[model samples]
Target: MSTPVGGDETQAPQSRFAGITAALRYPDIRTLFISTFANQFGQGTSHVIIGWLVLDMTGSALLVGAAFAVRSAPNLIVGLAAGPITDRYDRRILMKIAVIGLMLTALTLSGLVYFDVITISILLCGVFFLGAFQAMYMTARQAYVYDIVGANRAISGLALIGLAQRISQLIGALLAGTTILHIGGSGPFLAMAIGYLIGLTCIFMLVEVGDSAPDRQETIVENLINYFKALRSNRLLLSLMISTAGAEILGFSHAVILPILALQVLDVGPEGLGLLTASRFVGATVGIAGLAIAGDVKRPGALLLTTMFFFGISQIVLGYAQTFWVAVTLVAIVNIMATMSDVLHQSLLQLSVSNEQRGRAMGSWIIGIGTAPIGQSEVGLLAGATDSKTALLINGASLAILALIMAALLPKLRKL
Candidate 1:
């Protein structure tokens, strides 16, 4: 059931925490928030663990990217279908299925590595399934948060979700890194599997869907066909998707080369790489917390464009950092904008469409971010052929230029 909205909300006692307090008042949102923490914790650790594993087993940057590429490839393939699917079914059921998939995959990967039977082929297959489930779960979760919170509280709901994700990801990254250093085994993957179990338990507590249920009765193909038809006239959404895809393909792909940067460039090994990963969440925490406190933004498009521009520039600067601390600081700053871009994209996309269409809008977001595999492959191969520094310079510049071009050419987007 949807939370009843009251006109009195405008007259409520206010504080910096007002937005957060109101959203958490719902039991469903609270449990879902906890699950978010668990889910992202697994995700944070998986990125570092899987990337490092592929690197260790193959000793090739291109292979590492290829592994990550296989992992994210599902977004492009399954994301479109996932949108209408989530809207058509009970999202709670979909969430459970995705979490279960995560649990089994993580457990299998852990056991394979523990028994010393793991190979590059097995690892690749493992990450591919992990990525597919993650794509479905993320798209559903994005729409479900709105289902629980209603439109009035969407900004805060999404901001709070971002907070949970960033903090847990920070802990996950640090723990995964430390686990590698001390246990030096499958402990990280085991921990990841357990995290999904915890998340699944939380899903059991969810109640009912909001009043704004499915918008129309249509088959999956008919629903998608209409959405695509809508996109022809929805310039703002098209622009949003293009910009989101650009950021994923360029700015966020910096992660694909972190292993190379840690070992060859910074010489800090796994521990330092963990710090680099943790710093991203720290930066994201700042951005998300600020958004939660700031509450609803009247004009988010301008801010979104600004964040994308800086996000791109920071990546370019990161390529030139020599010291470990300097690189860490740069990574943190890069993600501050990165997460802001993320929050803006999800919030704006959900708000842009009707209640019933929100899932498909988010599905478009999934499709846009699916470009990550392309970026990952490019960075990994370029680093192997030339250097991590050069790859960063190129991708970073392209992203920054794209942001500027969007701001200039798509004036409607900026005004949205």
Candidate 2:
């Protein structure tokens, strides 16, 4: 039987996967892993494909940034609702709907491309809707992992799922590049749609995990009120949310300028851009694999801050990389720290809350990262005004400083 978060873990099934941890033994977790792989593949594919499309169309870094910013705009809208919605419904079905949304958007894009009627405005609108579904899927899947694995193995469950996500990102990015070259015409969007379709089927295969805990979540309005109240009371949660936002705003925003780097800096084409993108995911996969091998962590919060600091440091170095392979290596290093920061923040936040609040907490996490639009636009603008290298240098320094400041100011966060 699937164990709900906050359930008595000892009473759940004792079955274990022979080569893996207790978390993978649960069939639901395994199914979740498979679905997450497909889901993230579509996600990773869409981002690169769109960025390339924008660059190809306008040859403007600023416009590319705007398109990506539009893609992230849905996070702010859907993030708040995702919490209560996830808490209120069957997570599997919610995820299923989200995957279908992804498919529909991909199909729409393919059709638009095929007709040669794809404009910046039309593309931005489709990207916005596509991001909406991706945000929901991201939020629900984390809560789903916590529910099935419980607190004891939350790290393992999430890390394993992260592995799937990272691996798929690597493949998706590489394939997106190849497809853009080989298939040419509506191939990228069609590939994204197919990935989402496969992912949706995997979601249906998940054993239904219902949250029937005695203290069911209250109404949406009540949950919002409670969220604010909890934010006030839980300093660590507040710190986490802010820090998560800071990471996205400063560190992750560098992704917005990647097209510039590929064309102007790295002197590469779309296929080469794919290699650059995959380099980061390769780093993420390796970092997560290390974490998974380490098993349960004793100080995820402290480690998270450390990763954030290094994340900044790596970006600073990345700004100076002139050679293509050198650039790839630095990008990978940056994401190794980036993915570690992500996994730690997520696991720490999930462990901090009771099962009743888990979904909302994940939603809050989504909202935190939803701050990406501000960064995407900022970095893009900065690249437009200055060079890509200068923008990365400035943003990287700010992120490192932010990490150190948080470490000093938030004692409770470090202790966690």
Candidate 3:
């Protein structure tokens, strides 16, 4: 069979382009790329604003974590149903509605903030709705990339998409911090609303026909059963999902406590928090771009494991960082490894699964990611009990230890 980028056997040699720019050859993929950047930009902005806003309101680490938890908790609720819906419907249509929902949610939040009437309850409700839309939008987006590019180039396609997301995040984080400093919390929400609207415009421009028939026409319960059966049968996919959850729970969840680090530990204020967040994305963008330019990987599973090992070490050191610059350096290293691991995880899953089951497979992946709330909340609880640095040190050391064990045990997964 022909590859996603390579047209046919006759053109195989010519289609071996090393650059990620090759994915842009498809018009619809281009639109997807732009829309992804916009969505991530809004998220990047929210990442900064939400933590600071919560901290400002309750002055408690637990509440800050709870605020972010509420945002992602919806993924647990809607993640299972998202895949089946994506598989049964046109992903393009799903994306259109999802983006609209995100825009309205952001706008409503902005209005509440501007009027100075927003409460924790109201913010959590808005975040929950936003998370629900995001869950569906991202699942469809991942599957839609497969529709544009096939499995052979899935890694490269996802890497480039990650690159775009990181770049937008870099910009969004920096802008959000500056905006919040000058205009308060309302500014970031207004900016997020605008970003979602721009994302909707890009989605509207996508011309792909995204409808597809499922492999089986069973009832929803039957389909859910079959999905679990498939996961059980495919040990690689199951292992990958487990590893993803471990990484998220251990390493990536430190994002929620960064505001505390900025305020109490580093004493750099909101601007410093923004810089720290932007630094992470800058490193992520570099790692993803390097992977994209390298093209096809010979040992992606091994690469994922190796990167994760370093990620844990970075997290460990970040816990002990006493200076702002020191924390920034550690965050950069942590994100580079984190981004590589994520791309590898998604690529391997997409390559292993069939198109009909792609949405459900990714839904399972989302559910694993949803475990971030547990990790984040733990960090908050620990930080409140002790110190932010101590919380991070413990989290990081645990992650590294777990990653080592997973690598040693999952030889089958390592080979892929």
User: Best-fitting candidate, measured by TM-score?
Assistant: 1
Tens-digit lDDT string for candidate 2 (1-416): 57533334455433333113666667788888888888788766776788899999899999888888888888877878998788777777788888899899899999998889999889989999998998998888888887777677777778889999999989998998888888763788898888888888888898757333215867778877887788899888778888989999999888887788897778799988888888879999988876765667788878888899999999999999889999989888999899888888888877676677777788778888889899999999999999898889999999999999998998878877
Would you estimate the TM-scores of all the predictions? 0.96, 0.94, 0.94
Winner by lDDT between candidate 2 and candidate 1? 1
| Cα displacement (Å) at residue 92, model 3 | 1.1
lDDT per model vs. reference: 0.85, 0.82, 0.81
lDDT against true structure, model 3:
0.81
- Looking at model 1, report the run of 10 residues with the lowest lDDT sum: 4-13
lDDT of 3 at 399: 82
Off by over 4 Å in 3: 1-19, 210-222
Tell me which of candidates 1 and 2 scores higher on TM-score: 1
What is the Cα-based lDDT of residue 118 in candidate 3? 96
RMSD of each: 1.8, 3.1, 2.5
Candidate 3 clashes: the total is 0
Model 1, span 71-108: residue lDDT tens = 98999877888988987888899999999999999999
**Best-first order by lDDT:** 1, 2, 3
Stretches of model 1 off by over 4 angstroms after superposition? 4-13, 215-217
Residue 258 CA error for candidate 3 (Å)?
A: 0.7
